[model samples]
Target: MRVGDIDISYDDQGDGLPVVLVHGHPFDRSMWAPQVARLAPRHRVITADLRGFGETTVVPGKTPLGVFADDLFGLLDRLGVERAVWCGLSMGGQIVMEAHRARPERVRGLILADTFPEAETPAGRAARHAAAERVLREGMGPYADEVLDKMISPTNVRALPDVAAHVLRMMRGTSPEGAAAAWRGRAERPDYLDSLSRATVPALVVVGEEDKFTPVDVARRMHATIPGSTLAVIPGAAHLPNLERPAEFTDAVERFLATVA
Candidate 1:
Protein backbone atom coordinates (compact mmCIF):
# COMPACT_ATOMS: atom_id res chain seq x y z
CA MET A 1 0.00 0.00 0.00
CA ARG A 2 1.00 3.60 -0.48
CA VAL A 3 2.43 5.41 2.52
CA GLY A 4 2.66 9.08 1.63
CA ASP A 5 4.05 9.31 -1.91
CA ILE A 6 5.99 6.04 -1.82
CA ASP A 7 4.55 2.56 -2.18
CA ILE A 8 6.23 0.40 0.49
CA SER A 9 7.00 -3.22 -0.30
CA TYR A 10 6.64 -5.74 2.53
CA ASP A 11 6.03 -9.40 3.36
CA ASP A 12 3.81 -10.33 6.30
CA GLN A 13 3.71 -13.96 7.37
CA GLY A 14 2.69 -16.35 10.17
CA ASP A 15 0.76 -15.63 13.37
CA GLY A 16 1.32 -14.75 17.02
CA LEU A 17 2.95 -11.62 18.50
CA PRO A 18 4.13 -9.15 15.87
CA VAL A 19 7.81 -8.82 15.01
CA VAL A 20 8.92 -6.26 12.46
CA LEU A 21 12.30 -6.77 10.82
CA VAL A 22 14.15 -3.82 9.30
CA HIS A 23 17.06 -4.33 6.92
CA GLY A 24 20.26 -2.30 6.85
CA HIS A 25 21.54 0.13 4.23
CA PRO A 26 22.45 -0.89 0.67
CA PHE A 27 20.11 -3.81 1.31
CA ASP A 28 16.42 -4.67 1.32
CA ARG A 29 13.74 -6.75 3.06
CA SER A 30 15.32 -9.89 1.56
CA MET A 31 18.09 -9.59 4.12
CA TRP A 32 15.61 -10.76 6.78
CA ALA A 33 14.74 -13.99 4.97
CA PRO A 34 16.40 -16.25 7.53
CA GLN A 35 14.85 -14.48 10.48
CA VAL A 36 11.43 -14.32 8.84
CA ALA A 37 11.49 -18.03 8.10
CA ARG A 38 12.38 -18.93 11.68
CA LEU A 39 10.28 -16.34 13.47
CA ALA A 40 7.11 -16.62 11.34
CA PRO A 41 6.29 -19.99 12.91
CA ARG A 42 6.14 -18.39 16.35
CA HIS A 43 5.52 -14.73 15.65
CA ARG A 44 4.08 -12.49 12.97
CA VAL A 45 7.02 -11.45 10.78
CA ILE A 46 6.87 -8.22 8.80
CA THR A 47 9.80 -7.18 6.66
CA ALA A 48 9.87 -4.23 4.30
CA ASP A 49 12.19 -2.56 1.83
CA LEU A 50 12.88 1.03 2.72
CA ARG A 51 12.29 3.62 0.02
CA GLY A 52 14.65 3.46 -2.98
CA PHE A 53 15.60 -0.11 -2.12
CA GLY A 54 14.16 -3.37 -3.38
CA GLU A 55 10.59 -2.92 -4.71
CA THR A 56 9.79 0.21 -2.73
CA THR A 57 9.24 3.51 -4.53
CA VAL A 58 12.54 5.31 -4.97
CA VAL A 59 12.44 8.93 -3.84
CA PRO A 60 15.68 10.63 -4.88
CA GLY A 61 16.22 12.95 -1.94
CA LYS A 62 16.95 12.63 1.78
CA THR A 63 15.05 9.92 3.69
CA PRO A 64 15.73 10.47 7.34
CA LEU A 65 15.43 7.87 10.11
CA GLY A 66 12.21 9.54 11.24
CA VAL A 67 10.75 9.21 7.74
CA PHE A 68 11.72 5.54 7.70
CA ALA A 69 10.13 5.12 11.13
CA ASP A 70 6.94 6.84 9.98
CA ASP A 71 6.76 4.66 6.88
CA LEU A 72 7.02 1.53 9.06
CA PHE A 73 4.28 2.65 11.43
CA GLY A 74 2.08 3.55 8.50
CA LEU A 75 2.45 -0.01 7.26
CA LEU A 76 1.66 -1.36 10.72
CA ASP A 77 -1.36 0.86 11.05
CA ARG A 78 -2.79 -0.52 7.84
CA LEU A 79 -2.08 -4.07 9.06
CA GLY A 80 -4.06 -3.32 12.25
CA VAL A 81 -1.06 -3.84 14.50
CA GLU A 82 -0.96 -1.55 17.53
CA ARG A 83 2.42 -2.54 18.89
CA ALA A 84 5.19 -5.03 18.07
CA VAL A 85 8.74 -6.03 18.78
CA TRP A 86 11.04 -4.01 16.54
CA CYS A 87 14.18 -5.68 15.23
CA GLY A 88 16.85 -4.20 12.96
CA LEU A 89 20.48 -4.48 11.90
CA SER A 90 23.05 -1.78 10.99
CA MET A 91 21.26 1.32 9.65
CA GLY A 92 17.98 -0.50 10.20
CA GLY A 93 18.76 -0.68 13.92
CA GLN A 94 19.10 3.09 14.05
CA ILE A 95 15.74 3.37 12.29
CA VAL A 96 14.18 1.09 14.92
CA MET A 97 15.59 3.29 17.66
CA GLU A 98 14.16 6.27 15.86
CA ALA A 99 10.79 4.52 15.74
CA HIS A 100 10.83 3.98 19.47
CA ARG A 101 11.70 7.61 20.01
CA ALA A 102 8.90 8.69 17.71
CA ARG A 103 6.27 6.40 19.20
CA PRO A 104 7.40 4.65 22.35
CA GLU A 105 3.93 3.27 23.00
CA ARG A 106 3.98 1.33 19.75
CA VAL A 107 7.24 -0.51 20.36
CA ARG A 108 6.93 -3.65 22.44
CA GLY A 109 10.65 -4.50 22.47
CA LEU A 110 13.89 -3.81 20.61
CA ILE A 111 16.45 -6.10 19.00
CA LEU A 112 19.48 -4.13 17.88
CA ALA A 113 22.09 -6.08 15.94
CA ASP A 114 25.51 -4.95 14.72
CA THR A 115 24.73 -1.27 15.28
CA PHE A 116 25.62 1.68 17.50
CA PRO A 117 23.69 4.71 18.86
CA GLU A 118 26.45 7.28 18.68
CA ALA A 119 25.90 10.35 16.52
CA GLU A 120 28.08 10.81 13.47
CA THR A 121 31.32 12.63 14.10
CA PRO A 122 32.57 15.45 11.87
CA ALA A 123 34.87 13.13 9.93
CA GLY A 124 32.25 10.39 9.76
CA ARG A 125 29.62 12.79 8.43
CA ALA A 126 31.99 14.05 5.76
CA ALA A 127 32.93 10.49 4.84
CA ARG A 128 29.24 9.46 4.51
CA HIS A 129 28.46 12.44 2.23
CA ALA A 130 31.54 11.63 0.13
CA ALA A 131 30.51 7.96 -0.02
CA ALA A 132 26.98 9.01 -1.06
CA GLU A 133 28.40 11.08 -3.91
CA ARG A 134 30.69 8.25 -4.91
CA VAL A 135 27.73 5.83 -4.98
CA LEU A 136 25.80 8.29 -7.15
CA ARG A 137 28.74 8.67 -9.53
CA GLU A 138 30.29 5.16 -9.58
CA GLY A 139 27.07 3.21 -8.85
CA MET A 140 26.42 0.32 -6.44
CA GLY A 141 28.34 -2.40 -8.34
CA PRO A 142 31.72 -0.98 -7.43
CA TYR A 143 30.53 -0.03 -3.93
CA ALA A 144 29.12 -3.54 -3.44
CA ASP A 145 32.39 -5.09 -4.64
CA GLU A 146 34.36 -2.87 -2.27
CA VAL A 147 32.27 -3.53 0.88
CA LEU A 148 31.60 -7.28 0.46
CA ASP A 149 34.48 -8.32 2.69
CA LYS A 150 33.67 -5.65 5.27
CA MET A 151 30.02 -6.74 5.30
CA ILE A 152 31.07 -10.33 5.93
CA SER A 153 34.41 -11.49 7.30
CA PRO A 154 36.94 -12.82 4.75
CA THR A 155 36.96 -16.27 6.37
CA ASN A 156 33.17 -16.48 6.29
CA VAL A 157 33.08 -15.09 2.77
CA ARG A 158 35.22 -18.00 1.64
CA ALA A 159 33.52 -20.61 3.85
CA LEU A 160 29.99 -19.44 3.10
CA PRO A 161 29.97 -18.63 -0.56
CA ASP A 162 26.18 -18.56 -0.87
CA VAL A 163 25.84 -16.12 2.02
CA ALA A 164 28.59 -13.90 0.58
CA ALA A 165 26.92 -13.96 -2.81
CA HIS A 166 23.54 -12.99 -1.33
CA VAL A 167 25.08 -10.06 0.53
CA LEU A 168 26.79 -8.84 -2.61
CA ARG A 169 23.60 -9.30 -4.62
CA MET A 170 21.56 -7.23 -2.19
CA MET A 171 24.14 -4.44 -2.23
CA ARG A 172 24.52 -4.49 -5.98
CA GLY A 173 20.76 -4.56 -6.50
CA THR A 174 20.06 -1.50 -4.34
CA SER A 175 19.18 1.78 -6.07
CA PRO A 176 22.01 4.29 -6.11
CA GLU A 177 19.66 7.21 -5.49
CA GLY A 178 18.06 5.40 -2.54
CA ALA A 179 21.42 4.44 -1.08
CA ALA A 180 22.69 7.98 -1.45
CA ALA A 181 19.56 9.46 0.16
CA ALA A 182 19.87 7.08 3.10
CA TRP A 183 23.53 8.01 3.51
CA ARG A 184 22.74 11.71 3.65
CA GLY A 185 19.92 11.14 6.15
CA ARG A 186 22.09 8.86 8.27
CA ALA A 187 24.82 11.50 8.43
CA GLU A 188 22.44 13.85 10.24
CA ARG A 189 20.94 11.22 12.59
CA PRO A 190 20.82 12.16 16.25
CA ASP A 191 22.54 10.20 19.02
CA TYR A 192 20.14 7.56 20.37
CA LEU A 193 22.28 6.65 23.38
CA ASP A 194 20.39 8.99 25.72
CA SER A 195 16.96 7.67 24.72
CA LEU A 196 18.13 4.07 24.88
CA SER A 197 19.64 4.61 28.31
CA ARG A 198 16.31 5.87 29.57
CA ALA A 199 14.28 3.19 27.83
CA THR A 200 12.24 0.97 30.12
CA VAL A 201 11.43 -1.64 27.52
CA PRO A 202 13.40 -4.88 27.24
CA ALA A 203 16.19 -4.93 24.67
CA LEU A 204 18.59 -7.44 23.18
CA VAL A 205 21.87 -6.30 21.67
CA VAL A 206 23.57 -8.72 19.29
CA VAL A 207 26.86 -8.35 17.45
CA GLY A 208 29.07 -10.53 15.32
CA GLU A 209 32.42 -11.35 16.92
CA GLU A 210 34.24 -10.66 13.67
CA ASP A 211 32.32 -7.49 12.85
CA LYS A 212 34.83 -4.70 12.37
CA PHE A 213 32.30 -2.00 11.59
CA THR A 214 30.41 -2.26 14.86
CA PRO A 215 32.70 -4.38 17.03
CA VAL A 216 31.92 -6.24 20.25
CA ASP A 217 33.18 -3.26 22.24
CA VAL A 218 30.49 -1.05 20.71
CA ALA A 219 27.83 -3.69 21.39
CA ARG A 220 29.03 -3.98 24.98
CA ARG A 221 28.74 -0.24 25.45
CA MET A 222 25.18 -0.28 24.07
CA HIS A 223 24.33 -3.23 26.30
CA ALA A 224 25.70 -1.45 29.36
CA THR A 225 23.70 1.65 28.57
CA ILE A 226 20.37 -0.16 28.33
CA PRO A 227 19.22 -1.03 31.85
CA GLY A 228 18.32 -4.71 31.43
CA SER A 229 19.35 -5.51 27.89
CA THR A 230 20.73 -8.90 26.88
CA LEU A 231 23.89 -9.21 24.81
CA ALA A 232 24.61 -12.05 22.38
CA VAL A 233 27.77 -12.36 20.30
CA ILE A 234 27.75 -14.66 17.29
CA PRO A 235 31.21 -16.25 17.03
CA GLY A 236 31.84 -16.79 13.31
CA ALA A 237 30.10 -13.87 11.66
CA ALA A 238 30.68 -10.27 10.76
CA HIS A 239 28.32 -7.34 10.02
CA LEU A 240 25.68 -9.57 8.46
CA PRO A 241 25.64 -12.28 11.12
CA ASN A 242 22.06 -13.41 10.39
CA LEU A 243 23.21 -14.73 7.02
CA GLU A 244 26.75 -15.85 7.96
CA ARG A 245 25.73 -17.60 11.22
CA PRO A 246 22.01 -18.07 10.77
CA ALA A 247 21.52 -20.66 13.50
CA GLU A 248 23.28 -18.65 16.21
CA PHE A 249 21.58 -15.39 15.22
CA THR A 250 18.11 -16.98 15.13
CA ASP A 251 18.77 -18.74 18.44
CA ALA A 252 19.59 -15.45 20.09
CA VAL A 253 16.38 -13.87 18.78
CA GLU A 254 14.35 -16.92 19.79
CA ARG A 255 15.73 -16.75 23.32
CA PHE A 256 15.11 -13.03 23.56
CA LEU A 257 11.58 -13.36 22.21
CA ALA A 258 10.74 -15.98 24.85
CA THR A 259 11.20 -13.35 27.54
CA VAL A 260 9.54 -10.39 25.79
CA ALA A 261 6.94 -11.97 23.53
Candidate 2:
Protein backbone atom coordinates (compact mmCIF):
# COMPACT_ATOMS: atom_id res chain seq x y z
CA MET A 1 0.00 0.00 0.00
CA ARG A 2 1.18 3.54 -0.76
CA VAL A 3 1.66 5.66 2.36
CA GLY A 4 3.08 9.09 1.60
CA ASP A 5 6.31 8.80 -0.42
CA ILE A 6 6.85 5.08 0.19
CA ASP A 7 5.12 1.82 -0.67
CA ILE A 8 4.63 -0.40 2.38
CA SER A 9 4.36 -4.12 1.88
CA TYR A 10 2.00 -5.89 4.29
CA ASP A 11 -0.23 -8.91 4.68
CA ASP A 12 -3.67 -8.52 6.29
CA GLN A 13 -5.40 -11.75 7.24
CA GLY A 14 -8.13 -13.32 9.42
CA ASP A 15 -11.32 -11.60 10.59
CA GLY A 16 -11.50 -10.73 14.28
CA LEU A 17 -9.88 -8.20 16.58
CA PRO A 18 -7.10 -6.41 14.66
CA VAL A 19 -3.50 -7.11 15.75
CA VAL A 20 -0.65 -5.40 13.96
CA LEU A 21 2.83 -6.94 14.12
CA VAL A 22 5.83 -4.72 13.51
CA HIS A 23 9.20 -6.24 12.70
CA GLY A 24 12.50 -5.12 14.22
CA HIS A 25 15.33 -3.26 12.56
CA PRO A 26 17.24 -5.01 9.75
CA PHE A 27 14.49 -7.58 9.45
CA ASP A 28 11.26 -7.95 7.51
CA ARG A 29 7.63 -8.97 8.04
CA SER A 30 8.68 -12.60 7.50
CA MET A 31 10.16 -12.60 10.99
CA TRP A 32 6.62 -12.66 12.35
CA ALA A 33 5.59 -15.74 10.37
CA PRO A 34 5.32 -17.89 13.48
CA GLN A 35 3.17 -15.43 15.41
CA VAL A 36 1.11 -14.53 12.35
CA ALA A 37 0.30 -18.19 11.69
CA ARG A 38 -0.90 -18.74 15.24
CA LEU A 39 -2.73 -15.44 15.78
CA ALA A 40 -4.36 -15.11 12.36
CA PRO A 41 -6.56 -18.10 13.09
CA ARG A 42 -8.34 -16.11 15.78
CA HIS A 43 -7.60 -12.45 15.01
CA ARG A 44 -6.82 -10.04 12.23
CA VAL A 45 -3.03 -10.18 11.94
CA ILE A 46 -1.37 -7.43 9.91
CA THR A 47 2.37 -7.60 9.39
CA ALA A 48 4.23 -4.89 7.52
CA ASP A 49 7.78 -4.30 6.37
CA LEU A 50 8.99 -0.98 7.67
CA ARG A 51 10.38 1.58 5.21
CA GLY A 52 13.81 0.56 3.89
CA PHE A 53 13.35 -3.01 5.15
CA GLY A 54 11.75 -6.06 3.53
CA GLU A 55 10.11 -5.13 0.22
CA THR A 56 9.38 -1.58 1.28
CA THR A 57 11.05 1.41 -0.34
CA VAL A 58 14.58 2.05 0.81
CA VAL A 59 14.73 5.70 1.83
CA PRO A 60 18.54 5.67 2.43
CA GLY A 61 18.46 8.21 5.23
CA LYS A 62 17.16 8.87 8.73
CA THR A 63 13.64 7.50 9.30
CA PRO A 64 12.65 8.51 12.80
CA LEU A 65 10.49 6.44 15.16
CA GLY A 66 7.72 8.96 14.58
CA VAL A 67 7.92 8.37 10.83
CA PHE A 68 7.58 4.64 11.30
CA ALA A 69 4.66 5.19 13.68
CA ASP A 70 2.94 7.52 11.24
CA ASP A 71 3.35 4.99 8.45
CA LEU A 72 1.59 2.40 10.58
CA PHE A 73 -1.21 4.78 11.50
CA GLY A 74 -1.61 5.56 7.81
CA LEU A 75 -1.86 1.86 7.04
CA LEU A 76 -4.48 1.43 9.76
CA ASP A 77 -6.42 4.38 8.36
CA ARG A 78 -6.33 2.79 4.92
CA LEU A 79 -7.63 -0.44 6.39
CA GLY A 80 -10.39 1.45 8.19
CA VAL A 81 -9.29 0.10 11.58
CA GLU A 82 -10.25 2.52 14.37
CA ARG A 83 -8.18 0.86 17.10
CA ALA A 84 -6.29 -2.38 17.62
CA VAL A 85 -3.69 -4.19 19.64
CA TRP A 86 -0.11 -3.28 18.69
CA CYS A 87 2.62 -5.89 19.13
CA GLY A 88 6.28 -5.30 18.31
CA LEU A 89 9.80 -6.48 19.08
CA SER A 90 13.09 -4.62 19.50
CA MET A 91 13.00 -1.44 17.38
CA GLY A 92 9.49 -2.33 16.33
CA GLY A 93 8.44 -2.27 20.02
CA GLN A 94 9.80 1.24 20.31
CA ILE A 95 7.77 2.25 17.25
CA VAL A 96 4.64 0.89 18.93
CA MET A 97 5.39 2.99 22.00
CA GLU A 98 5.86 6.06 19.79
CA ALA A 99 2.54 5.34 18.09
CA HIS A 100 0.73 5.06 21.40
CA ARG A 101 2.31 8.29 22.59
CA ALA A 102 1.22 10.11 19.45
CA ARG A 103 -2.31 8.69 19.36
CA PRO A 104 -3.19 6.85 22.54
CA GLU A 105 -6.83 6.38 21.61
CA ARG A 106 -5.90 4.26 18.59
CA VAL A 107 -3.97 1.72 20.61
CA ARG A 108 -6.15 -0.89 22.32
CA GLY A 109 -3.23 -2.71 23.99
CA LEU A 110 0.53 -3.21 23.72
CA ILE A 111 2.66 -6.33 23.47
CA LEU A 112 6.30 -5.36 23.83
CA ALA A 113 8.89 -8.15 23.52
CA ASP A 114 12.66 -8.05 23.86
CA THR A 115 12.58 -4.27 24.11
CA PHE A 116 13.27 -1.43 26.54
CA PRO A 117 11.68 2.02 26.94
CA GLU A 118 14.76 4.00 27.92
CA ALA A 119 16.35 6.57 25.66
CA GLU A 120 19.70 5.66 24.11
CA THR A 121 22.62 6.34 26.38
CA PRO A 122 25.46 8.49 25.11
CA ALA A 123 27.73 5.46 24.76
CA GLY A 124 24.89 3.50 23.16
CA ARG A 125 24.29 6.26 20.67
CA ALA A 126 27.95 6.31 19.74
CA ALA A 127 27.92 2.55 19.26
CA ARG A 128 24.88 2.80 17.00
CA HIS A 129 26.58 5.50 14.95
CA ALA A 130 29.66 3.31 14.61
CA ALA A 131 27.52 0.35 13.59
CA ALA A 132 25.79 2.45 10.99
CA GLU A 133 29.13 3.46 9.54
CA ARG A 134 30.45 -0.09 9.68
CA VAL A 135 27.44 -1.53 7.88
CA LEU A 136 27.54 1.19 5.29
CA ARG A 137 31.25 0.59 4.74
CA GLU A 138 31.42 -3.20 4.87
CA GLY A 139 27.89 -4.11 3.87
CA MET A 140 25.58 -6.37 5.91
CA GLY A 141 27.27 -9.74 5.31
CA PRO A 142 30.17 -9.20 7.69
CA TYR A 143 27.97 -7.81 10.46
CA ALA A 144 25.33 -10.48 9.97
CA ASP A 145 27.96 -13.21 10.21
CA GLU A 146 29.47 -11.65 13.31
CA VAL A 147 26.16 -11.17 15.16
CA LEU A 148 24.41 -14.41 14.23
CA ASP A 149 25.01 -16.02 17.60
CA LYS A 150 24.23 -12.79 19.46
CA MET A 151 20.85 -12.51 17.73
CA ILE A 152 19.98 -15.96 19.05
CA SER A 153 21.61 -17.95 21.85
CA PRO A 154 24.75 -19.89 20.89
CA THR A 155 23.05 -23.12 21.91
CA ASN A 156 20.05 -22.37 19.74
CA VAL A 157 22.34 -21.47 16.86
CA ARG A 158 23.64 -24.99 17.14
CA ALA A 159 20.36 -26.78 17.96
CA LEU A 160 18.04 -24.92 15.62
CA PRO A 161 20.11 -24.72 12.50
CA ASP A 162 17.26 -23.79 10.18
CA VAL A 163 16.04 -21.00 12.42
CA ALA A 164 19.57 -19.71 12.74
CA ALA A 165 19.99 -19.82 9.00
CA HIS A 166 16.75 -17.93 8.50
CA VAL A 167 17.88 -15.28 10.96
CA LEU A 168 21.22 -14.94 9.23
CA ARG A 169 19.65 -14.80 5.81
CA MET A 170 17.32 -12.03 6.88
CA MET A 171 20.13 -9.96 8.30
CA ARG A 172 22.45 -10.56 5.39
CA GLY A 173 19.80 -9.72 2.83
CA THR A 174 18.89 -6.42 4.49
CA SER A 175 19.87 -3.32 2.51
CA PRO A 176 22.97 -1.79 4.08
CA GLU A 177 21.70 1.70 3.26
CA GLY A 178 18.37 0.91 4.89
CA ALA A 179 19.98 -0.65 7.95
CA ALA A 180 22.32 2.30 8.33
CA ALA A 181 19.43 4.75 8.07
CA ALA A 182 17.49 2.88 10.74
CA TRP A 183 20.50 2.83 13.07
CA ARG A 184 20.94 6.57 12.64
CA GLY A 185 17.26 7.21 13.35
CA ARG A 186 17.12 4.80 16.29
CA ALA A 187 20.00 6.53 18.04
CA GLU A 188 17.79 9.59 18.50
CA ARG A 189 14.88 7.64 20.03
CA PRO A 190 13.30 9.22 23.11
CA ASP A 191 12.50 7.39 26.33
CA TYR A 192 9.04 5.86 26.34
CA LEU A 193 8.81 4.94 30.05
CA ASP A 194 6.60 7.90 30.79
CA SER A 195 4.20 6.97 28.03
CA LEU A 196 4.05 3.35 29.09
CA SER A 197 3.46 4.32 32.70
CA ARG A 198 0.56 6.55 31.71
CA ALA A 199 -1.08 3.95 29.49
CA THR A 200 -4.45 2.68 30.68
CA VAL A 201 -4.69 -0.19 28.18
CA PRO A 202 -3.60 -3.74 28.85
CA ALA A 203 0.08 -4.54 28.26
CA LEU A 204 2.11 -7.72 27.91
CA VAL A 205 5.88 -7.66 28.18
CA VAL A 206 7.69 -10.74 26.87
CA VAL A 207 11.41 -11.26 26.85
CA GLY A 208 13.81 -14.10 26.26
CA GLU A 209 15.41 -15.37 29.44
CA GLU A 210 18.77 -15.35 27.73
CA ASP A 211 18.35 -12.06 25.87
CA LYS A 212 21.72 -10.36 26.07
CA PHE A 213 20.54 -7.13 24.46
CA THR A 214 17.54 -6.22 26.63
CA PRO A 215 18.07 -8.78 29.46
CA VAL A 216 15.45 -10.07 31.90
CA ASP A 217 16.05 -7.36 34.50
CA VAL A 218 15.19 -4.61 32.02
CA ALA A 219 11.97 -6.35 31.05
CA ARG A 220 11.13 -6.84 34.73
CA ARG A 221 11.57 -3.15 35.48
CA MET A 222 9.40 -2.23 32.47
CA HIS A 223 6.72 -4.67 33.54
CA ALA A 224 6.69 -3.31 37.09
CA THR A 225 6.29 0.29 35.93
CA ILE A 226 3.17 -0.43 33.89
CA PRO A 227 0.15 -0.94 36.12
CA GLY A 228 -1.56 -4.32 35.62
CA SER A 229 0.94 -5.40 32.93
CA THR A 230 1.99 -9.05 32.64
CA LEU A 231 5.48 -10.34 31.95
CA ALA A 232 6.31 -13.74 30.46
CA VAL A 233 9.91 -14.85 30.28
CA ILE A 234 10.52 -17.50 27.64
CA PRO A 235 13.23 -19.92 28.66
CA GLY A 236 15.97 -21.22 26.33
CA ALA A 237 15.63 -18.33 23.91
CA ALA A 238 17.67 -15.26 23.15
CA HIS A 239 16.82 -11.97 21.41
CA LEU A 240 14.21 -13.37 19.03
CA PRO A 241 12.19 -15.65 21.27
CA ASN A 242 9.19 -15.60 19.00
CA LEU A 243 11.25 -17.51 16.43
CA GLU A 244 13.57 -19.46 18.73
CA ARG A 245 10.80 -20.67 21.04
CA PRO A 246 7.70 -20.22 18.95
CA ALA A 247 5.28 -22.24 21.05
CA GLU A 248 6.12 -20.53 24.32
CA PHE A 249 5.96 -17.08 22.77
CA THR A 250 2.67 -17.82 21.05
CA ASP A 251 1.19 -19.26 24.23
CA ALA A 252 1.94 -16.09 26.15
CA VAL A 253 0.40 -13.99 23.38
CA GLU A 254 -2.66 -16.26 23.22
CA ARG A 255 -3.37 -15.82 26.93
CA PHE A 256 -2.84 -12.07 26.63
CA LEU A 257 -5.23 -11.84 23.69
CA ALA A 258 -7.89 -13.71 25.66
CA THR A 259 -7.69 -11.10 28.37
CA VAL A 260 -7.74 -8.29 25.82
CA ALA A 261 -10.89 -9.75 24.23
Local accuracy of candidate 2 as per-residue lDDT tens digits, 162-250: 99999998999899999998999999989999988999999999999999999999999999988899999999999999999999999
Model 1 misplacement above 4 A: none
What is the Cα-based lDDT of residue 161 in candidate 2? 98
The Cα error of candidate 1 at residue 81, in Å, is: 0.7
Q: For residues 1-261, could you state the per-residue lDDT of candidate 1 as single tens digits?
A: 898878999999999999999999999999989898899999999999998899999988788999999999999999999999999999999999999888889999999999979998999999989989999999999989988999999998899999889999999999999999999999998999989998889899999999999999999999999999999999989999999999899999999999996
Q: What are the per-model numbers of colliding residue pairs?
A: 0, 0
The local distance difference test score of model 2 is: 0.94
What is the C-alpha local distance difference test score of each model? 0.93, 0.94
